[model samples]
Target: MNPSQNEVLTPSQLIFIVNGLLIGVGILILPNSLVKITQQDACISTAIGAVYPLYICLIITYISKKHPNHNILFLSKKYLGNFMGSIMNLLFLIPFIFIIFTVTPSITNILRIYSAEFLSPFKLIIIITGVCLYTAYNGINLIGEICKIIFYVSLPLIILPLFAVQKSSILNLLPVFGSGFNNILKGSIETLYSYTGLELVLLIYPYVNDKKKIKNSLLKGIFLTTLIYVWCVFITVYYFGLDLTSKSLWPVLSASEIIDIPIINSFRYLFMLSWTLILLRCITIYCFIAVYILKDFMKKTDTKKIYFFIYPILVFLSTFFTNEITRRNFLVKVTPIMVIFLVIYVSFIALLVRIKG
Candidate 1:
């Protein structure tokens, strides 16, 4: 494939993909975790913590806007030389895979726990790998269209709490800062992982047709996601309080479990349904980035053959670690370094783009 064959995604499609990328994986777990730290005032801590990532998005957008028709990978190669740029891309690629390995299984475990305990893990693994591979096999355009579909379906899942609000107490959010700034900041760092996927926009900026609008769209998408996250945090904290939410492994789902109604009487089922939608979207987008990063390294765009390579590698890597406890351990232990790496990675890209563009 050549430069002329490249297709830039429209700002709206990029926004759709960005929305999907921002909202998945951690949203279900992190809100509950924050309750442990934030206690009664978790909502304030969460909303305040959102600022740091939104700032990072803006900085990356600044860098992205400087390169009209290129992405971080291209800019890095231009300024840092082939070897170093490839290393940076690989750095991102590793974390991207780690994300896939960690998130898909967590989602699967949740599904098994609530939706279907009889579903075989191996069968579920194939289903996830197949969906990721299918998304990877298609080009970026199809990826965006899939995201568009995902965003609509997920809207309900993310917002389902609004329906069953009779028992919620805004007072559950009282006793502000009992945890202090340090613990709250700690929650922010932990929650930061949930919001980091918005920066995947940096990876896909090249596919956006108008570079100028990319920054605004990126921030807009992040803003909406962060807002939803804040609302969810409020709901969980208000409903469950800190002690209960902290003890629960899947806090978001736990909170959802309590929601009852004449309409459905089961929030867990709705939570699982929504979780799957975002999970599919998030995996597809990340795998696409991982495959393309490899393709850029190899100087090819024939995504079909590349998906063949990725699917097996991921399946094999995924098998080494089984059980939710092991997966959660890896995700928690490695995620901070992942965020640190991301901060540096964005700084590196911003600097390179400034130097070269």
Candidate 2:
């Protein structure tokens, strides 16, 4: 269904959207990257990385309160002027596009590895992108509702790790700071890339129905995301220790493999199936934002037509990184750059708003 252009999200919907965007494929593999950097202190890095989102949320709240009707697109043009602001707005659009490119391949590869080996990468990409396109076509309000449902449905899956905790040793988490302060800080920077979605708040701010509650809703969302990331890293480290967690590509999935459920023979498959919905939501949200930004630039274009134009390109580009190593390497190089750029971009915009006021 085509939502009205004036569609507005409630604070709870805002909370769920933030959580939905933050949780994605990052949770599945973050422990591996963190453990590689900080060893057993990976959870600490995960917790520290949360400060990035917290900072972004503060900036969003400040800017949104100051200019409730203006999204980053218009605000940039207003403060930075037509030429520079348009450049900045175009630059702002890149990360969302990168997310779609990187995550589309990553999620498809993940499903292939865990469950859908029979399916070709292109087929998987098409299926996933098709669902996302449909959702994006319906607009942000539907995406918000979907996020709320997926949040409630998939949250209980976090507890699945506890079933495997019996095999974990608290000793695995000992010598926590043994990774050293510098390494832990570096790990925090690396994990900070996983929090990419928080920047979308700037774009979505104008759509929030209860502007007064955006601050609290954003904080609630970021806190929930941080809690889950820390738990995933902590559990992975606790269960597999530094050596195994660092070596494993998808450490969380590896951790899930060990859970013994009487009803289900392989909890890993169940876990993968459940998270597939979460991953879909993550991609859909990014796709929607990308389309939304593009529509902002081309006001006369229908959003659904934009989706049709974009999906084929997403499908084709996604094929380039179907290999696991290629996909991981691309994201590793690209995501950090995107994160750093976003941080600087938003901070500069916030400063501009404050000064011009």
Candidate 1 segments whose C-alpha is farther than 4 A from its true place? 1-6, 265-267
State each model's CA lDDT, in order. 0.76, 0.87
- TM-score, one value per model: 0.92, 0.96
Prediction 2 global C-alpha lDDT: 0.87
Residue 46's lDDT in candidate 1: 72
lDDT of 1 by residue, 1-357 (tens): 123344558888877877888777688777767776767767777777777667787766787657666677777777888898888788877887888777777767877888878987766877887887796576788888878887787777667777777787766677677778888877776677787776677777776767778777776777777787888888877778777778777777777777775777566777688778778788888888888788886665566778887787777666655587787787778988988898888887787666765
Task: Determine which window of 10 residues in candidate 1 has minimal summed lDDT.
Answer: 1-10
Best by TM-score: 2
Write model 2 residue lDDT over 1-357, tens digit each, in one string. 122565778899999999988988888889988888899898888999988899999999999999887889989999888999988999999888877877888888889888889999999999999999898788778889999998888778777777667776899998869999999999999886688789898988788887899999999999999988898889888989889988898888888888887776867777887788888999999998888888877889877788898989999988998887888888878887888799899999999999998
Best by lDDT: 2
Q: What TM-score would candidate 2 get against the native? A: 0.96
